[model samples]
Target chain A: MINRTRYLTQSVAKILIWIGALSTIAMMILILFQILREGLPVLHLGFFLDSPKNMGREGGIFTTIVGTVALTAVAIIVGAPLGVGTAIFLREYTRESKTSRVIRFGTDCLAGVPSIIFGLFGFVFFVIRLNMGWSILSGGLTLAAMILPTVISTAEESIKTIPSSYREVSYSLGGTRWQTITRVVLPSALPGIFTGILLSIGRSIGETAAIILTAGSSLVMPTSLFSPSRTMSVHFYILAREGISMKMAYGTGAALILLVLMVNIIAQWLINRYIRHRT
Target chain B: MAMKEKIIEKILLLTAFSSIFILGLITFFIFKEGLPLILKIGIKAFLLGEKWIPSKGLFGVFPMIVSSFWVTFGALLLGIPLGLACAIFLSELIPPSVGLLLRPAIQLLAAIPSVIYGFWGLIVLVPLIQNHFGGPGLSILAGSLVLGFMILPTIITISEDSLKALPPTYKAGALALGATHWQTIWRVLIPAARSGVVASVILGMGRAIGETMAMIMILGNAVKMPTSFLDSARTLTTNIGIEMGYASGDHRQALFATGVVLFFIIMALNTLAISLSRRRVH
Candidate 1:
């Protein structure tokens, strides 16, 4: 009788667990379905290429798309080198130093600070003090700061995972430390580095608060780095908050989700391919 | 040959060392921009002042601070148990194939952008609460619920890993002693994984406090202190995002002051989390 009871309980527990797991999947499908249901009718070629004007319902998100791409590009350009540099320092150069430990602590602290705080800092330091004045440059720099910790941590992990044998082989070939890092170690870890970059790009694309604060919501296509611009995420927020047509908001939202999803899929594929190739 | 190699090595070392300077620059910029505002506002007024009106130079961040803590605490209250239970089910009770499907689904939930969450909360959740509870569409309850779902993945993933890491012998020992599976989980697995569970909770709290877009959208952006769970409230993150756009003069500084306070709170939480995890590592 006890054995039967135990089996019954286990079966019940398994059912419960399955229910919990399925609920999450169901939620995601529901969200995607809702978004497509509301958003699909409005999606068009013009919607992707047109700029926002006349209360944003009639106009498309061309400028916002361009602005997002520009800001992300600039952020990657500015942040990637620094992040990779920091990672190299942590893993290869100062593996056990007090200064590196402090750097690691500070990086971790920076990572945990809220995105909104980064916005405030960006507003004061970049927009005002540096006189960038809520332009693309300010927004990009802010995003660079926001994503630095992510890049550093991911890069560091990737670097750490590179087998010591690769480094030893390079050294045996009489390669200098720099050569070993630049060639053997980094090549082995290239996929992880790319993964970090892709993750940062996804984060930058989805970011709303930091950009809204630092990047002024000018609906026009940015003329230059110093000019104000609106990103898709920011546009989505504005449309949602200002009581625009729900159809328009959903349309823009679907576009935003699609963009992120595409990037995520591509990045995951690239990382997987790289892993397979290396193996 | 020796000289050339030495020079190249020095250059590589210099490039590596520059990261230290970059980290320093980040901290310096944060404090440099934020400290003066704190000094001018006076720490007492900044912490305790009721009103946040910046026109007359009163920059009290107390209400925002209260709201931040309130939302975080509320989220923790809801998310921790559900997340832990989910983790327990995943780690202990579930079959391998089911665990695999569930794990990715949880990650996908985490990967969904906060803006989508805000939209979902606005359209679906806020109305549900308002219809039942009779308040404005935006309320602390809405914020907590949205944030609870947002941080659920964090807690679940961390707690699941911790539970998974427990020695199999521990479970067997309990089973041999005639403890039921549920009893062993409640009495043995949980206690043994206490530190990790604590870390997961802290991490969840950190995410909750830091979250901006969804909270801002759902919390009604009310600047006043919350009177009840149904009352609308603003958090430090939302306040910063809302005001940072047009703020100038003392108002801007006050925003930076808010950032400073947020920075310290997160810093403290992260330190605690790291130390706890390090202890477990040792």
Candidate 2:
């Protein structure tokens, strides 16, 4: 009786494993279907081009798209250089010591801090304390901080992958540490570094809570960095939660999903290419 | 040249410290804002008391705390079994060609924005749960379902990596010793990858607990201890996200206090994960 039951349970576990794997695929498809089905009907050229006229109840999302692009641009400009520098410093400037361990611990903690906490930090530090107010700059700065850990970790991993032989060659030629990193090492790790940037772009684009607190939801088009604006994600949140118009929300959701998938695909492709190139 | 390189190194070093600075600022500012409320209200009442009314000035996050744990527990119940099974399927059971197709889907699941998940959950899962499972539908069950899906990628990826790291010899030896295929896997491979699996589950737990945007949508936003999976609940993340907009003075501080609690929970989980993975490597 016990052997028979064990056999049955083992077979059941095997079958359940198939279910688990297939269900993941089914879930992804279901999400895509729901987004496209509800959203595609309302999407049009006007929806993409026109600005929100009545508190996102009517018209398209022209300004918000621009705001997202501009905001992401600022974040990339601020975060990318800092992240690359930090990765270089961690990998090259010092040995793996207590300082590096602390930095790693700090990065891990930063990565795990809830998005809402980051939003709170941005609200107090940027919006109120720094007098940036509800602006794209504040939101972008907040997102930079949030995505910094991802960038640092990825960039560091990529930089680590570059063979030490290249650095040794540079040093044999009497090159300084800075020369070795900039001329020989960074170029080799460029694709991987680019992948990190793209991943951060994806992260910053999808982020809502952090931006919502820092970037005040303004109906009007933003005029400058100091102007408040709504992102597509934040816009979708309001429309869905407020029960404004499910049609528009679905449309925004669909667009946002497409953008994210595109970004992810590109980043994945870049990573693969980098790996192939390295090998 | 030496001077220029020294300057370059200094700049990079400063930038390297920038992330640590940001982390410090976040912890300091949050504590600066949140500690006042905790001190005034006393730690016990703040953490353990069972009431949370901003207008009445009664700040007790016990309900939200319990709700957060339950939701995370619920998510683990759904995510871990499926994720671990899926990890085994990919690493040991399935062919590479099949894994090639399925793996990207899991990664795509990770890349999809939290708000999109929220919107989808609001429109699809919430109504489905409401119809089938009853209640408001936007309850602990719905949140768990969404969170379960959200953590699958994290769990599956790490678990699969750990499983893959095991030597083929282990399986070969088990089969050589007259063990059946399933027995070899069940008894040997799983026990070997235990640390990675635990780390994956802990990391997934961190992801589930800290998730804010998606949780806010399907969790029904009820600040009460849920008696059942179908009951409405609020998590620490949703509590802060929903109220931080217009919250002023002590109310704002109270939300910061909620963030502080969340920080500790996430920090603990991350530390545990790092230690587990560290041990696994050794």
Write out the backbone clash pairs for model 1: none
- Please give the clash total of every predicted structure, in order: 0, 0
- Candidate 1 CAPRI level: acceptable
lDDT, candidate 2, B1-282, per-residue tens: 989988998888789888889999998889999999999999999999888999999999999999999999999999999899889999978889788767767788888889888888888888999899899999898899889989999999999999999989999999899776778888999999899999999999999999999989999998887899999999899999999888999999999998889888988999999889878888
DockQ of 2: 0.71
Identify the runs in model 2 with alpha carbons over 4 angstroms from their true place.
A1-12
Predictions in order: lDDT: 0.82, 0.89
Q: Interface RMSD of candidate 2? A: 1.7
Instruction: Give the TM-score of each candidate.
Output: 0.91, 0.96
**Accuracy of chain B in candidate 2 (TM-score):** 0.96
DockQ for the candidate 1 complex?
Answer: 0.45
